[model samples]
Target: MTRRALGRRYLSAWIGFSAGGRFSQALATVILMFAFGQPTVQALVGSAGTWAVLVTLVVLGGLSLLGQRYRIEWHGVLPLSLLAFVGYCALSVLWSEYSWVALREFAATLGFIGLGLYLALGRDLVQVIRASGDAFRILLVVALGLEVLSGLVLDVPIPGFGIRGDIAYGGPIQGIGGTRNFMGFVAAMALVTFVVEFLTRSVTAWRAVASTALAVIALMLVQSPITGLAMIALAVTALALWALRHAQPRTRPVVNGVLGVFVMVVAVVAVLAHSRILAEIGAAGGSASRLALWSQLRVLIEQHPVQGWGWVGTWPSEPVVPFDVVLAPSGLPFTSALNAFVDAWLQIGLAGMLILLGTAVLAFARAWVTATTFPGVAYVWPAAVLVLLAVTSTAESYLLHGAGLMVFTAVLVIAARRRSWRGRLPR
Candidate 1:
C-alpha cells in the first residue's frame, strides 16, 4: 500500500477502537468521575469528552472524504433517517419558541448524525462494540475499586466495598453525569456488556468483580426513575436475546418464559423500592401543564402539521408554547419540559413528530436487520439500549442535554450503522 493508504488504514483502526461501546463506557466512567458531587459542573465539563469525540469523528470523516475511500453499501434506510432529521430541523425553525437556541441544539444533533453515518461508512461496527465491551468491563473494575476507597475515606457506605464514603473525589477521571439517571444508564450498559462477555467467552474473576460493582451502581440508581426503569426494561430484553442465542434445543421456550417472569418480578420490585419516582410524576398535576404547552404547538402544527414546532427552544425558561405553571415545580426559575416527545412536538410540530417516529422505525429496522444478518453480534444489544434511551426520554430531559444527549447520540449512530464487516474489512 502507498503511504497515504497506510495512513488511512491506521486511522481506520484508531476510529474502530474508539467506536466500541465498552470504550465509550470507560470514557463515560471517567467523565462520571468529574460529575459526582457538583451536578452543574458535571453537566458542563462532561460534555467536553463528547465534544472531543465528535472532533475526532469529524477529522476521520474529513480524512475519508480526502482520498480515504470508505464506503458502506447497505439498504437505503440511513438516507431516510437523515432526511427525517433534516425535515425536523426545518420545521423547528418555523415553529420554535426560541429559534436561535433551538437551532444550536439542532446543530449539535446533526453533528451526532454525521458521526453515526461516518462510523457506518468508515469502519467495522462489530469490532467497535466488542472493544467497547472490554473497555467497559475494565472501567467497571476501576469504578468499583474507587467506590470502595472513597467510602472508606468518607465514612459513607459503599455497597460492594462494604466501606463508607471517604475516598470519592469529583473530576474527569471519575464522574460523568451526576444524577442517578445518567449513572443508571452507564451501569446498565456495563452490566449488560459484562453479561454478553460472559456468554460469549468464559467467566473470569474480573468479570465477577465488575458484575458485582455494576450491580451496586444499579441499586443506587433506583431513585433515578427514568434511568432505573429504562435500564431494567433494556436488561430484560438483553437477557431474552441472550437466551435466544444460547438456549438449549428443548429449553429455548422455557428460558424465554423465565426471562419474562424475571422482568415482571424485578419491575414490581423496582416500583416498590422507588415509589418516589412515581410520586414525583403524580405531583406534576397531570397533563394540564403539558396540554397548555401543546396548545402553542397545535397552532404551529395546523399551519404545518407535517413539521410543527420547527427547532424552537432550548433555554430553560423559554417555552415553545404557552404552558401552565403546573408544568414545573413551583418557584424554580426553570426546568426542562422533561419530555423529549413534547420537546419534539414543540420544536417541529407534526413534521417533527413524523421525523421522531421515523427515527424510531429506523432504529428498529437497523437493529432487526443487523440481528437477523449477524445473529449474536455484540453490537446488537446497543439497539435495545437505543430504544431504552428513547423510551426514558419521554419521562426525562437529560438525554437531550449536555452530556446525556451527546453520549447517546454517538452510540445511536454506532448502533444504526452496524452491518457485517467480516469479509469486507480485514479482521
Candidate 2:
C-alpha cells in the first residue's frame, strides 16, 4: 500500500478500537488504576511516568470520546458546576505570579479531568462502581502484599515509594499511597464501594464479602485518625441511606426532614465535643499539626485574599512563596495545605473557593436525593462516597488534582446527569 493509504488504514483501525464496548470498560479500569497508582508510579518511576501516563491517556481518552461522541447527550451534557470550577482554575493562569507553574499544573488538572469524564460518560452507573471497586481491590491487595514483603520478610523500609515496612509491628503502613493516612482513606473508600456492590447485586455475595474484608483489614492496619473520622461519617450516612431507602414513599419527606435536623445536631455536637472526638480518634497531635499549617496558610491567603497565589493544584516539591511559607510540624515542606478548602482558598481565592464548595454542595444534594428516591441500591453509592470524600477532605487534601479529583469528577458527572435541571430541556 502507498504511505497515504497505509496511514489512513491505521487511523480507521485505531478509531474502531477506541469505540469498542470492551475498550470503554477497560479504559475506566485503567484510568482509575493510573489515578490511584500515580503516587506509586511517581515514587518508583519518576516524573516521566506521570507525564507519559497523562499524555497517553489524554490522547487516547480524547480519541475515544470523539469516536463515541454521537452516543452522549450533547445538550447539557457537561456539569456546569464542575465546568465553572475548572474554568476558574484555568483562569488563575492569567494573574498567577508563577505563570509557568500555573500552566503546568492546569495541564495536569485537564488530563485528570479528561480521563474522569471518559470514565463517567463512557459507561453506566454500575460500571463505574464496578471499576472503582476493582481498582481499590487490586490496589489494596497489592499494598498488603508489598507490606508483607517489606515489613515481614525483608524487614526494611522502601523509602522511595514511602512504604514504611511496619506491617510487622501492626502497621501504619504507607503502601502505594505514599502515606499511611492516604492508604487508609483509599481503603475506606474501598469499603464504601464494596458495600454498595453487595447491596446493588453488582458482585456475587462472596466476592463482595471478600472485598469488604480486604478493605477493612487495610483500614485497620493504616490506623489513620483521619480515616477513622471518614469511617464514622460513612457509617452514619450508610444508616441514613438505609432508612431513606426503606421508608414509605409518602413518609420519606418526614424522614428526610428529621434526618436533616439530626445531621445539624450532630454537627453542632461535634464542634462542641471536638476535643473528646480528637482523643477518641487519636487525632489530637495530627490535628495540632494541621492547625499550625492552616494558621500559616491563613497569613499567606491574606496577601491576595480575593484572588489567591495561583492554581497550583499540588504544591511544588521545591519550595516557593506562599507554599514555601508553610512547613509541617516535622520541619519539612508540606505538599498540600492539608485541607482541600484551605488549599482552594490559597490557590484560587475566596470566589474560586466558593465555586468549588458550591459544586460539591450541589453534587451531594443531588446525590442524596437520588439515593432516597431512586429505585436502585446503586443510587446510594454516589451519596455515600461523597460523604466519605467530603469528610476526609477536612483533614487531607485528596480532592484536588489526582485520584481524589478524578473520583470527585466521575461521581459529579454520574449524579449530575440524572439530577441536573439541564436534563429537562429538549435536546
Q: Which candidate tops TM-score?
A: 2
Model 1 scores a TM of: 0.62
- Model 2, residue pairs in steric clash: none
| CA lDDT, candidate 2, residue 106 | 91
* lDDT of candidate 1 over 295-351, digit per residue (tens): 544554465455554563343344434332324435443345557766666556655
Task: Report, for every candidate in turn, its global Cα lDDT versus the true structure.
Answer: 0.52, 0.88
lDDT of 1 at 402: 44
Candidate 1: list runs displaced more than 4 Å.
Answer: 1-57, 64-68, 71-77, 94-97, 134-175, 202-212, 215-222, 242-306, 312-327, 333-335, 398-427
Instruction: Please estimate how well model 2 matches the true structure, expressed as its whole-model Cα lDDT.
Output: 0.88
Clash number by candidate, in order: 42, 0
Question: What is candidate 2's lDDT per residue for 1-427, written digit by digit as tens?
Answer: 9999999999878977897888877878888888888889897768878899888987888778788888876566679999899999989989988898789989889888888888888778899989889888899999999999999999988889898899998989898899998898779888988998998888999999999999999999998988888888888888888898889999999999998999899999999999898988788988888888888888889999988889999898765776776777668888998899999999999999999999999999999999989998898888988898899889888899898898889889888888889989877
Off by over 4 Å in 2: none
